[model samples]
Target: VNPVDRWDGTPLADAVRAGHRQVVEMLSAAGAELKLDVSQTSVKLCDKAREGSVEGVRLLLDGSADVNAADYDGRTCLHLASATGNLMMTRELLKAKANVNSVDRWGGTPLADAVREGHSSVAKALLEHEARLEFDEVKTSSELCECARQGDINGLTMLLTAGADPNACDYDKRTCLHLAASVGNVAVVKRLLEHKAIVGAKDRWGGTPLADAVREGHEQVSELLLAAGATLDFSAERDARELCESARLGDIEGVKLLLAGKCAVNATDYDGRTCLHLAAATGNLVMAKELVAHGAGVSITDRWGGTPLSDAVHGGHFEVAMELRKHGAELKYSRLKTAGELCELARVGDTNLIRTMLAVGAEVDASDYDGRTCLMVACATGNMHVVQVLLDAKADPSVKDRWGATALADAVREGHAHVAKMLLAVGASIDLEPSEVVSRLCDYAGAGQLEHLELLLNCKADVDAADYDKRTALHVAASAGHLHIVEHLVSRGCRVDAVDRWGGTALSDAQREGFTHVCKFLEGRRQLVVLKRSSSQEQLNLK
Candidate 1:
């Protein structure tokens, strides 16, 4: 009698929610339709079923409700079933032609949901129903990830035997072996190795399984990896300093084994730092002596022309420094003549030893290849006592380094406000023209030294000085989201419209670096903010 009888509405949806099968059937016959578009309808059904209300789901299905109906976020009935791990309801929905691969707006499908949550039976059912095996072309079946994470050798073995790709990688190029090694699943790792999974396979950043094992301090896993013929000298990633890194960590046993396995004794890292350098830097007198005895080249100069002796002296390792000197390690070299030794001594506040070196005719004011004097090093290292000692020794404070940085510039660069004040008190000039003031200021701002920046500004440092790249301090501050610095620079009459060598404005740099706060600040100032198209814009837009 009612025209509304033909339309789906709340009463019939409520009947479905109540799980009253007879009432639901009567309502269906009376043409009381179930509302598919109601915001709470699908959610109620999902909630009922997830609460183990099997009758509710059956009644809804028999009434010809949308088997694949989605809630507000596009999570379908199967997604709810998988989430609740209701195997029977999930099987029934699959039999009714429910889309096994239907994903929420977040790209989470039934299989992904099941695997992520350890719904093993639901995951198996979905897989049997031909669910998509891979998610986003990189992350493999969440089932595999779960099994590896749980150390479930049996579950992992089953998945692999069921045609799961053992070699499938995650978004970070982390193969199953990487995950296994990370978790220290020795048995699972052995199985994977037996399956010929790439033992030396590198991840996105070039970390191998062995690297993972070592980093996590998994002793058994590390031993297994080493026994599997993983190259001891394998420098796959930032972990290239593997053996030396281990030694530096004081993994004496690990270091001994790695060295015994023929890792290069003098392998220099990206910084040209060797094992002996690290040992000396840490003041591990025993390790330093061991490395030297093992033929470590103590004389090998770092990128800064610093030897083991310099590292020891700089790190305050008097005993290690004495040991290195005993091994014929000279602090001063004719070539690459730098005050690295004196700077090292200053860094450790070793005034007595510094005087000893001076008494032995060590050049008190020698500059390095970069023309950085001991005074500049002292200022950069923020050691006030060392600065005073150097100043008293008649060290030149106004000398510029190869980078055109004076002692005052180094102090300001490192955000040592107290040290900068000390230098200023000693007649250090703050008005010298730095070759790349903008770049240096940008670096300092990026490091979050607002006080140091204030000091520079108060000294009336150039507000719009350009670096070699012609970028102003404003651009650097904007790019790095240093709002206070940007505000200060603007207050000091920095040109808001200045363009860098790349023709980018401060606003452009802010947007490029995704600095929303800086961008908003610049926009409020009515600055000409250019929106440049980045190569990764398409990807960002998709996200």
Candidate 2:
């Protein structure tokens, strides 16, 4: 007679549902207890609360029914009362000391459901009963986001007033401010901002409130965020390499977000291309102007020396070229295609591009803004066929870069000995003096480029060449603890006793820097060799 239905409702629940007082009393008297836990049901409490039956809930509470018992889905009596906007039953449950913050399976608290269901009075009552919007950050953030996304200002206010975090974020770190700004909810945004919500908080994907506002064309929201001291997010922008790609794809909206986030106006990729370069190549004149207005230099060059101006001209964007010239970009290169274009083609290792550009009357011997020639670019990248083609076209190999590095010097510096030999065959100059010695040997040794060091020495570069402080390759090698380069330099007859301006030899440098192996080798070798060279065999014999 007391069997439960498939919905977890017993005969007592049916009696209560139909308001049959005599049967409810008879069922209770016939051993029908209302208390049930997790897997079963908080059936009597939930049904009474859902029907706003204050007396039914009171009878159960007086019958020793557990006030905090929840159903299988974790929906407690308080959750049902609050969700149905039943203030009387909610207050009755609160009077019985109900768990106001009980979470349902969907992570909804009583206050959260009340707020989301537009039950302002019930939410207020729940808040007055000290109903926490969230005891869990994940659970609470979801409720806050629900209120914000629906533009329910009253519920949002109650949550915030009850000490809910203004910047509650979901799993993706998408904050309520991001949602509010994106939806153009000005009043909700104002309410959140009043609670001190971060105007430029970035999510997991680097999406910020202000960026969201701008991307969604919410001008007023954007202005509000900007007025709140929202600027670039350099930390997020560094890891986000999306700006260059956005510019290339003509995604101006995404560019606005990335540009606002990425502080560097001239930020470049691994290919050394900037947003301006991408915009010019794609003929996005509007994006180019935006970049220029934000202090992007039109004369900025890529790894192959391709500038925004030259890229614009090469792409036949005459309007973009004219616009670039107005921003102090000079058309300094000769002919139809710029020298930077030729240098870029040479760097690509495409022999056909070189021939085609050259056939179009492109200047071969001219230098780009970086003062690097096509032949130098070709030799630096070790593009054999491109180098041969340029050499055959009478491209001058003698031109030095801005760093005063000839094509041969560039080749040798990059360890391209084969290309260096080719440049030498064309009468390219080589100077293994102080500049070359310091740049090539010391740099290679300090960077632990033992192969480059061996190549330089094999090319007959001065073994003991030193810089201004008289710091040689051995000094840098020892200081940097490159034991292999130190041993190789010692084998090549570089003097260990040669002193710097500080009067410290390579041995002392190694010892001071705590290089045990280098110190041991130098200490053992020092005892075998004379400190100062003897001018004559008689002087050596006397020593």
Query: For this target, which candidate reaches the highest lDDT against the unseen true structure?
Result: 2
> What TM-score does candidate 1 get on C-alpha atoms?
0.59
Query: What TM-score does candidate 2 get on C-alpha atoms?
Result: 0.47
* lDDT (10s digit) by residue, model 1, range 1-543: 112345545566667667677887787888776656545556765666677766777777766677777788988778888888889888888988989988787888887667666678888898888886345435553556667778988767755654567777777778888888878889989988777777787878687888777655677987888789875345522433765687678666656655665666688888888888888888889888878888989889889787878777666677888888888887656534447667767777778667645543467778877887778888888988888777777877888888677888878767788888887787887655566555556666676677877767655578788888888788878888889989888887788888878899998999989999988888877533233334357669989
On residues 347-446, what C-alpha lDDT tens digit does candidate 2 reach at each position?
8886765664555446788787778888888988988888889998998877877877778777777888778778777676665456766667888999
Error of 1 at 245 (Å): 2.4
What are the lDDT scores of the predictions, listed in order? 0.74, 0.78
Question: Could you tell me which 10 consecutive residues in candidate 1 have the lowest summed lDDT?
Answer: 526-535
Residue 370 alpha-carbon offset, candidate 2, angstroms: 32
Off by over 4 Å in 1: 5-11, 30-32, 38-41, 141-163, 194-196, 204-219, 222-240, 333-543
Clashes of 1: 1
Clashing pairs in 2: none
Query: How does each model score on TM-score?
Result: 0.59, 0.47
